[model samples]
Target: MSIRANLDVVHERIARACLKSGRDPAEVTLVAVSKTFPLERLQAAADQGQMVFGENKAQELDEKATAWTSSDVEWHFIGHLQRNKAPVVARHADVFHALDSVRLARALDRRLEEENRTLRCLVQVNVSGEQSKFGLDPSALAPFLEEVAQFERLRIEGLMTLAAPTDDPEHVRPQFSLLRSLLSTPAPGGNTRLRALSMGMSGDFEVAIEEGATHVRVGSAIFGNRSYQ
Candidate 1:
């Protein structure tokens, strides 16, 4: 299908999902995951007024953000982040979505301070505990939130998680719900700035909305097969 066609269908789906959950469709923001897509596609989406896009790699984000600097697209870092890449990632992204540990958070904190910019970040929790996933163990959340709260350069926006792939919505419901609950709870250092719940993707965004996902990242559903990647 054409990109425009894909976008239209996805938009309709989002609306339908929101209506089904009794939510105003305006409450949810759709982020196009442009990880390996070309600049042309990114520009096309931006031109169409789709303001938010996500990239999974630091270097890729750096290149895309620079190449498309003239446009007004918001960038999100949605992949595993390495400490060494924090500098470039912080420089280019509006929000870092894969902040998995205290170490990564500290690195981002220092980098943002150096750049004199504030970074909005989500504490990635491997709620599913999949051995291959990258995130802070759920048990370590309290103290980690406390330490990250001390960083003035980074603002805690709330929690993000990847649920194990399963067809049963009931099985996945609790995991997304838990992440939503985290936002209302106080952070360790008394920082209650958490407001964003970035979760869900093409396969399960309706579940995410019902569980309170303010932002949902959708790639193939919007951009098709990721031609440039």
Candidate 2:
């Protein structure tokens, strides 16, 4: 199927999910994960009215942002970002979804201050407790949010998490629920009224939406599989 066709199907699913959960479809933002896909794929999705794109690497996001240069194409840095690469991500990304540490947050904040810019960021929580995932432990979120609040240039938007990869989407429902619960809980010493829950992907977004996901990052469903360079 064409990218536009796939997007229609995805949007239909999102709408149905929202209807099932008694929520507005507008409450959920679909972020097309465009990492490893070519500019042509992005152009195709953009032609179909997709404005938000998520890239996993800072370098790739910088390259793509420079190549596209469309003010309408809002880029999101959604992968594990390194402190050294914080400057690039801070300069180009409109929203960041994998802020898991104070060091990384400080780095990004410093760079944003220098650039005279402010960034919207989601604190990533490792709810599944997977050794392979890159996020802060759930128990540490409160203190982490407190520390992060000190950074003036970084705005704490909400929380983000990657569910445990499983064949049955139901297996990861608890993880999504946990993220929602965290978002609802008041953070210490900060008004962390998280408005965005960046959970879900192409395979399990419906379940995530039912559990209260405000942002879903979908890739293969829209752009097909990754084309490695």
Candidate 3:
């Protein structure tokens, strides 16, 4: 299928999921994960009205943002971002999804302040308790939010998580439930800036949508499988 055709199918699925959950389809935003997919592929998705693109690497993001100079595109840095790469991510990204530490937040805030830019960010929570995943522990999220609130330029919009990969999407439902629950709970500083749930991906976004995902980062579904060879 063409990118446009694939996008239509994805949106239809999102709408169906939203309908099933008694929510507005408009509430969920589809972020086409464009990492490792080259500019030509991005152009294909963009041509089909995909406004938001999620890039996982710092260099890819910087290059893509420069190459695809469409003021319409919203860039989301949806990966583990290091402190050293913070300045570059801060410069190119409109939303930073994996904000797991104070040091990374501080680094991003410092650069945003220098450039007179404010970046919307989501606290990445390791909901599945995977050591390999980079996010704050569920127990540590509220305090982390309280500590992060002091940064002037970074707005802690909500929470994001990558559920444990599974064959049956139902297996990861609890992980998504946990993340939604965290979003509802009040933070220490009354920093209840919670709304968006940046959960879900190509494999299990429907389940994420049902669980209350505001932003779904879908890559392979809409653009087809990426080739490394």
Candidate 4:
């Protein structure tokens, strides 16, 4: 299928899922995951009025940020961020989606302070209990939040997670539910604005949306298989 055709199907699925979940179709934002895809594909999506593009690598995003500097695209960093690379990420990303630990958050916070800027980030939760994933376990979220909430440069927008991939939807549902439950936990001082849930992708975004995903990361569903430069 063509890129546009894929996008059409994905949008249709999102709409249907929204209907089932009693959510407004317009309320669910589609973030095209452009990681490892060509710049032409990104331009094509832009032509189709896609404003948000997510990338998984700091170097890749830095290159895109330079090449597509003229385009009005909202770049989101949606990969596991090492503390050492936080400064580079701070330079270009509009939003950081995989902020899993307070240490990394503090690193970015320090960089933002030097750059005189603030960043919007999601606290990535490892709801699947996957040791391979880089995210805070649900139990550690409160202390992590408390630690990072002190930073003036970082704004905690919401939570994000990658459900462990499984063919059966039932296996993934708990991961999604755990994320949703964590979001409902009221923060101290009622200042935590947990509005965004960056979950799901091409394979399971519909389930993710039905469970309360405000932002879904879709790549292959829209762009098909990515071709490297």
Candidate that scores best on lDDT? 2
> Clashing pairs in model 4?
none
Tens-digit lDDT track of model 1 for 1-229: 7677788888888888788889888888898999888888887787777889999988999898887767567899999988999999878889888887778878888888889888888888888879998887877777778777777788787888888898776688888988887776667544437788888888888888888888899998878775553
Instruction: Compute the lDDT for candidate 3.
Output: 0.90
Better of 1 and 2 by TM-score: 2
So what's the TM-score on candidate 3?
0.97
**Better candidate number, 1 or 3, judged by TM-score:** 3
lDDT of 2 by residue, 56-103 (tens): 987888889999966888898999988999999889999999999899
Each candidate: what lDDT?
Answer: 0.83, 0.91, 0.90, 0.86
Candidate 4, overall lDDT? 0.86
Error of 4 at 80 (Å): 0.3
Cα-based lDDT at residue 195, candidate 2: 78
lDDT of 4 by residue, 140-173 (tens): 8888777777888888889999999888766797
lDDT of 1 at 210: 83
* Stretch of 10 with least lDDT, candidate 2: 184-193
lDDT of 3 at 206: 98
Candidate 2 wrong stretches, greater than 4 Å: 188-192
